[model samples]
Target chain A: MALKHSVSGFLADRYDMETATGFLRKQAGKRLPPHTSWLHVFGSLSLLLFISQTITGIMLLIYYRPTPDEAHKSIQYITAEVNYGWLYRQIHAWGATLMILAVVLHMTRTYFFGAYKKPRELTWVSGVLIFIVTITFGFTGYLLPWNQIAFWATTVGTESANKIPIIGEWLRYFIRGGDVVTGETLSRFFVVHVIILPWALTGLIAVHLFLMRATNLATLEPVGEEKPIEPKHGIPFFPVHVCKESIVAVLLLAVLVTLSVLAPWEIGEPADPLVTPEHIKPEWYFLPSYQLLKYFEGPYGAFFGIVACSVPFLLLFLWPFLDRGKHRHPKKRPIAVGIGLVGLIGALVLGYLGHVSETEQTFFGTRYHIDHYGVPHRVADKSRDEGE
Target chain B: MSNRFLGNTEMNEPTPQPTRRSFLDWVIGLFSAVTVGAMTIPALAYFWPAAKGGKGGDVEVKEAANLKPGESAIVQLQGKAAIVRRDASGLVAYSAVCTHLGCLVKWDGARKEFLCPCHAAVFDASGRVVSGPAPAPLPAYKVKEVSGKVFVSTT
Candidate 1:
């Protein structure tokens, strides 16, 4: 219990709950939707991923600079300055991918499980928005390092935007802030990555959670049951679920740290407008787009690519209405669930394709053996000729 | 003389013993106890995570002599920035930090200077702030040779 002294007399607050038999008391004690299974862990994992990024990001920010000229050098200093600076960057880098993955999977799970049914539609929609924002965050962060791969990848991004016919050119200008990927682009991306997207997502998440509390976390009873179906599958959200999430999150962090320790992230060659990158690819999260670029032809390819990318959001936005089925079981609603699986697999395959060097196109065409993609690629053995 | 000695001494002075009395005294005593507890708890709690040291840094690059002559090395021994330098003497080590605004400096040997096209801050071999409005000089770390190995500080 907490005690507070009032102006006129002593006022006390009680932490204990009385076992009242009233209707309001019953509502207060009513258990939430029975999502006790591991299937629900991904949302918590997404939250954990965000926490990881924020922590790693703050640490990296101590070393990272926003200036176009000094940004890369500051990164080198972090690697060479304080201990484990590279680890900070690597963890955040990998954590961003994992964060995107976790949130996407969480949304997919919600869709497959029919958790987006009436009254919980906003939770699912906001979640989809969160996914898009996470990817946007990744895209903006990718260029902050300003390496060759980052440069060309962003070039691919901006140019792809320029293919949208009329608004395409304007949108590219809006995003890049001028003619091409220049100092303005870096500054603009910095703002979007560090401030804009995060602020927007934070508000969305708050509203999403409020709606979640209002909807009571959607229990696992039969959809049409009115007389209060069995509540045996339910569990308290705190000590039970939250505890598991903490453990899983710590373990995941440990694994990521080990990977970072074994192999730190490497910034490739500097961005040179004159020199073409040996072979460039986006961060793992954008493999699908890279693959899309490969499949499509010139300007039309970009337009089709944009349309392909935008379709998922449209589907996600309408998922609630489309999935108006009465069943929440895996046995039911096969089509929606199938779409989710195909999308996940498609993303994975595209990511795999992006990592392969043989099929990639590069100007010099000699970096095939340099840094293999897929996993986080770091610096190579340049002790003999680095800076030479 | 006795008063001076008494003022300095602890054994001679008489002190009052505790007595249960006024409500005001009791209230004052309670508030003081609460205040102390509040101050101590938060202070200790704040230090706990810091003490555990979740904050990690980079490994320091070792030895100015590891690379023979003008040989450059790309180091990913920690995580983010790669330390690329052909520095044979501790005289210089360029931060792979991009000069455009300190991303991660990369060396352009054909160009013979550090280039950060993000805003195009370039630095010469001396690690001096060569071109581009790099507000500060490239940091030169103190490294010594020990058993033929280079170590960078990542604390």
Candidate 2:
């Protein structure tokens, strides 16, 4: 008791500890809906990953040279020379992937629970904004490595951004800071990645959290019931919810570390503007859209492709208003659930398709020999270099 | 908040004792605790940078004088198994990572083929998959003998 008093006294002397503690206690005591499970952990997990990324990103920045000529060399120095630099770099890279995934799952969970209806509309909107910002962060960060894959992937990524009909050319030029991806583009991306996006995302996240806490927590049932059910006893946010959150964060961090240790992130050959790789692919998160664009050709195709890709985001943003049915149970909402399932399955299929090489087939012997690209060609007419 | 007829202690119901439900709870709690501990230790270690080893770059596997015709040696090339074989033609090196799922491939001297134990995928002397579920031929690395030392470089 004496030790606690001294520590409390010291903290109080240094700051407004009492008031801060009171505020925290009040926030912790907030009543959270019952039936909270592992599905609800994604938001906190994403936040944890975001925090990890921020710390590791700052560590990387100390050694990372943003200049085009020096960037790749600087990265190599960090990986090969700096103490624990490889760990930090791998954590940051893997963290970004995991953060994106967590955010997606969190959003999906929100949708599944119909948590976006009515009072939570602003929170949902802010979450969607954060999702966009996160993806943008990924797009900007990919080029910082300044490797061959990064260079070509950025070129392909920006080229696709150029397919946005009227604003296509301007958007491309704006992103690159010139007609081509050169030193200027690198500088622009570096500044945006390190400074601009972080600030914007932080501000947006603050608002998101504020909105989330300001409203009552959504439950399994839809709001606006004609005959209200008996109010269920809510669990306190402090000890109960916080304990679960900590457990999830710790487990996730452990998993992230294991992955980092097992497979240290690879740095491909340094960027050579003169050469484009035989096959270029963007980061996996963007695969669905990339695959979508491949099926279409010409200006009209590009226009339609852009529209098709935009539809999901549009639907997501407008979901609360779109799904106005009284029933929140997934079984009762067949149409909504079916649509979500289709979108998920389509994304998965497209993601897989995007990573694979497309090859044409030619008639061969009964036991046809498949080529490198999975294309079959006749052994009788096999050329010296038929497929890649 | 007073209950009626509380004085009649003999009529009161007996308090429920712990049952199989409590036992199940204890089992789950113990399992969860173990799982959490198991995850935490390795995760903490993973944060530290792995020790640097001379594995990935140009690694000298064997001496040219020691390896005769039809002889093979499994060398750790960049933390992956690589087989260096000396035949009548010259020295050849093939990646030991199987094409199917990256299981380490083993050299079979009698059969003269590289075999994956995971799924029984087989690669011939040239690192081409002869049978099973492997999708692509094993990657071949360039091998050079300089001053009687065989150096293998992964391209």
Candidate 3:
């Protein structure tokens, strides 16, 4: 007790300990808006996933080699040789997928609630920016595995920039660090995924959180309307809201562990620039865009495809300004809700198409071959002849 | 003492003179700019991708007799992907890097075409774009057959 008092006294001499503790306690006691629901957990869940990713990513980095020559070999070593290295790798991989999912869900919730209105415009803008950065994090991180899919997907992903008219070629060269995806490309991506993107994301998340705190969570109140939160009437941030977040975090960890244990991520064949994989598909998140780009062919197709893909992102970023509606409820704003649904459905359909493209699959009784353009063509079933 | 530090006449006159604080500010500004430039210039240069290694020279693919007709071998020419194919006419070579994207095109000996797997872009035996999204044909390289050995020029 005497030692504790001395330590506290030493700290108190340099800092206002009482005031700091009081301030933290006040923040913890702050009340959330009355309308705050279970749906709001997604944002916190995304944060949880990001934290888990950072921890796992750091652990994986201990053995990961950025060079193409050793990248795949290092991953194999980590998975098979090192103890629990596979667990860290799997958690990081699953964490990325879950993080993207959580971010999308959070954005969807925010959109449906019409939370991007009036004073909360900046918050919405920052949130959208964060979402874009998060997607980019996924894109850059996908290539770190240095596998066949990583190589080809990055090839296709970077090559898509070649449609940007005059600067396209230079841009591709810049992105790849050369004429082709080589060791240099791997180095560049490793630095970006590990260093540049993390810093960028941290800054973006800080800004987002700051804006959200400043504006407070958007209630179901109409635009330009504010319902003052009362301490007794609303949910207390401490023990109540924090408890909910804690439960979600625990559940998220359980799911991540379950995924890591059930299906550990495989380190596929190392990247071969010379031998392109026959079926090179990007991660599921990029499927919608990948399928969409297939439709745009020829000289002008790439340019148009780029524009088509960019339109949605542009719209999403500028949504706060575009949506001049007074209503916060989905029922009140029919047009906005309809457009949102259409986009959601369209993305889902495109993703499904992408999943099935360049492959033969039997849906119901008919065997259909989905081509590069994601167009289904009925083909004669050959499975009966070679049936089990 | 103040009057002695600044000449008595100068102190009496209300002339605008550079203060020590302003002088220090200017020095700090210059140092800051120099410091930033010192850091930024190297960083900017770092992003400008490493230069391709080695001077352009003849890279030996294999023995001219080794590669039979309709056979192709992908080799590194001056640190870039290059393909050497033996045809009925003669030994021909082209940069294997696809014109559509940077994917290395596989030599389809049966079809006698260079096939890019990324976007299904096809190039004929002559490195001409036959179909698909490739805007240009694969660039040809000079193949020299000397002393029973085939060499692809990287210049």
Worst 10 residues of 3 chain A by lDDT: A379-388
**lDDT by residue (tens digit), candidate 1, A1-388:** 2332352133123322233335445454555556556777888788778877888888888888877688788878887776988788888988888888888778877767777887688888888888888989999999988877787678767766766667876676677765456677888898888888878878877887778767766654435542342446456565666677778888888978987888777977667643434445667777776654545433254467678877867988888888777777666768767877898788777767666633433334333332232323333436646766
Instruction: Give each prediction's DockQ, rounded to 2 decimals.
Output: 0.01, 0.01, 0.39
Return the lDDT, model 3, position A139. Answer: 90
TM-score of 3: 0.89
- Fraction of native contacts under 8 Å reproduced by each candidate: 0.00, 0.00, 0.46
2 or 3, which is superior by DockQ? Answer: 3
Candidate with more favorable, higher lDDT: 2 or 3? 3
lDDT of 2 by residue, A356-376 (tens): 534333443333444332344
Winner by DockQ? 3
Models, CA RMSD each: 20.2, 24.0, 4.9
Question: Candidate 2: which docking quality band?
Answer: incorrect
Q: Is model 3 an incorrect, acceptable, medium or high docking prediction?
A: acceptable
Candidate 3 lDDT by residue in tens digits, A1-388: 9999999999999999999989889878878888787888999899888888888999999999998889899999999999998888999999999999999999999999999888888888888887887888899888888999898889888988988989998888888898678788888888888998888888988988888877778878898677778878888888899999999899888999999999877788998776778868888889999888877776687789899999999999899899999999899999999999999999999999899888988888788988777788999656776684
Root-mean-square deviation of Cα positions for candidate 1 versus the true structure, in angstroms = 20.2
Worst 10 residues of 2 chain A by lDDT: A364-373
